[model samples]
Target: MDTINTDILICGAGAAGLTLAIELARRHVDFMLVDKIDGPFSGSRGKGIQPRTLEIFEAMGVVDRMVAAGGAYPPQRKYRADGGYDEQPSTEGLAPSPAEPYNLPLMLPQYLTEGILRDRLAELGHAPRFGQELTGFEQHADGVTARLARADGTTTTVRARYLVGADGGRSFVRKALAIDFPGESMKMRAMVADLSLTGLDRGAWHRWGDGPGQISLCPLMGTDLFQLQMPVPLEGDIDTSDAALAAVIAARTGRADIALHAVHWRSVYEMSSRLADRYRVGRVFIAGDAAHVHPPTGGQGLNTSVQDAWNLGWKLAAVVDGAPDALLDTYEAERREVAAAMLGLAGKLLEAARTRGDLRRGRETQQLDLGYRTSPLACDARGDDAIVRAGDRAPDAPCRGAAGQPLRLFTLLAAGGWTLLRYEPDGAGVVAPRKGLRIVTVGMDGELRDDGGHLRTAYGFAPGEVALIRPDGYIGALASDERGPALNTYIANSLI
Candidate 1:
């Protein structure tokens, strides 16, 4: 009998898998990440790494290196209410939030981003177990048994406390779990290329939508070329020809002064915004594109995927370290809600993209920055209000923790422990332990000014009240009136 046991075995050694591997390593957890591709592909995938994502990297201890490898973009473009970007916030909007330095979008290609993450994982003394393609898995009473096809064509069994599928949309692990990924495909086709451009203007992201064709040209880091995202509607695959694609670019920019290089990569995806019905089944969990595949509207695909890995990593390690198994369920309950909302938002983005209408409603009202606001872990000061309140990813802000030293809220989060803060002190600290729990109560001065600021505005307060922060950056449960009981219950339950 051949059996290998690990705390976690992640399939798909892409961005999400490598990130999780790093997290597990940080927690001193033994895990393995596998992928079919052993080497990096030159093809340009994703380019824009939002500020929030960078903040996450900073927390995970990998941002400075990426920033050094790539340069920082001072300003990004902001499209007007009418499919146009002139002056709204491009270079003008500096994340208006004090908690986060939302100055510019960190410009790096997906491949380079992956390289940086792989390097970080190695620094933590773990390399991805490349060329091991996942074949299947069987979940037993105590552990999960995974079968993978090696590069030599030999099959090996890997047993683990749990399994995560960070593979792409067509995930083998998802199939083994028999979960359904539900969503519709829009016939919107786009030719994406990361190469030198002739006439695409110099800006963070050049968004030009007009009669012939609309194109988004974003300059990539380390390369003189810019990544061009040329859109072709569902009705007609207009640029089915190479010459036609060049013509489309010329028409959109109205500048024939562009030089073309060999196409590095090209794909025609039917922008299908989708999400899985369930994120967890038995001992298997799905994350990244495997959990939700959607159009790259808000550039949320990879961000959400990383968020999934972050949320699941600590919980998986916690369970392995003797925390109650039930703690893992929160991952599904929390991230799925976010993914479902993201699917809805993606559909809206596509609709707006197709109709080409008022972008103000889409940009301001959509509130991609503020939309997430639900989680029992983040229940309100009272009970009803807290449970039904906004559930989403927690925001980061600058703050003076119990230690009067200069610290970021994210920096204060114990690498692998729970964080509790008392935003208001009415009665939050008195709550009794409903179950296994861990919490820290930071006093917040209660004040409500505006859905008005950035991440700091979202989660910041003055002093006295409590703010409960989860390890994955979600609010577990907060209370102003009863501090103790609420604190005890939330943490005790999670720690069990």
Candidate 2:
């Protein structure tokens, strides 16, 4: 067997894995991403990208492509038994603001999103190695040893400083560690497929019937195909052939005009809500579907998985760069809480779909309100109630550069690493410089001038106050003064 060595070994090249790969690659970390499948997935599963995820993608330098490839969710058209249809908004009512620019979800297929991330990763001199399967792995005090089986019946031994499993629900890494996945499987099943058809309007999301026989056909953005989803009987084998799908659509919609030309990809899955008992075991970790599984109700699975990878990527990079090993512990503490709450929300939404036929998604599904306010890494010395706390997501605002040039707060933060926003009148500061950290003053005579006091209004920062923004875009610490002991202590303990 050939032997390979790397700083990090990431298994599975889905959304979560790809996000992590881009994170590491941009940071110039030595890592390897591998997937068992022969090529990229072609399905249109997990097509909704929430507003919060859009912000993360901006930092990763792929938001422009994602926006161009996606569009707003269309109005839902529910057909009644009398052949008339009722139209209603599919998402909540929210407009774009300076603080929250991307307020609504973007409807982009998962495969396209992964392709953009892959393209970004390749630009950074890395790509996922396909046809490589992780047969098993073992952990040591300082690293992990994994065995990989190739498509040609050959094997390789990999020694990595850390291992991350982004595999699906039945993850090999989670199973090898014997992690307990404790949750209930809802007694329901559904068939999801991508179909190329004709004779149906491509503007609205069309729905037919209700209860256990409801079927929906949603038009995919920038594609000639429609994604079909329908509930399946609980006790029988489902035939996923193209002809069978076409017949079922005809019977459910009571319309012979609609046709199904081809079924590109199809899958039948039982509704389940599960969370791993633990996210980390020594040098090995599990993320994405390996850590939690949810019903396809609120389109939260892929978004949640992306956030999981975002949270872990920075912490892992920090630990590898000689930061305290305990920094890695925060990954589980912060993300596990979020995964648990999202799981419950998805379950409730699934039940509502079955009982009340409610399909309207509210602002809670946007994932903007989720944060790590109670994490051990957050520190606040303001001693006053503020809209944006130490652990909340740092909002963006328009500002002017030192030379009177136009720019946005996100543009500066998107350069990666930690940022210190010092709200002071004078840009006079000789704070000791640190790698991966940048300090920018925002005031009348500072390096960045608040365009219209929007910066202070969004962050609630006083004239002498300062806020530390983490690499993952969360506020790590806030202090009353730039030269405060609280800020120094936070950096010394958590960041250094």
The residue-by-residue lDDT of candidate 1 on 156-194, one tens digit each, is: 799898899999899888878889988887666666776
For candidate 2, what is the lDDT? 0.90
Model 2, 1-496: lDDT tens digits are 9999999999999999999998888777899899999999999989999999999999999999999998889999999999999999889957988888898899998899999999999999999999999999888888999999998999989999999999989999999999999999898999999999998888999998878889999999867889999899988889998889999999999999998889989999998889999999999999999999999899899999999999999888888998888888899999999999999899889888887777889998999889998899889887667878888888989888889899899998887789998897344664566888898878777789987888888988778888999999999998877777778878777765
Which runs in model 2 stand beyond 4 Å of their true positions?
425-427
Candidate with maximal lDDT: 2
TM-scores of the candidates in the order shown: 0.81, 0.98
Clash count of each predicted structure: 63, 0
Q: Give the TM-score (vs. native) of candidate 1.
A: 0.81
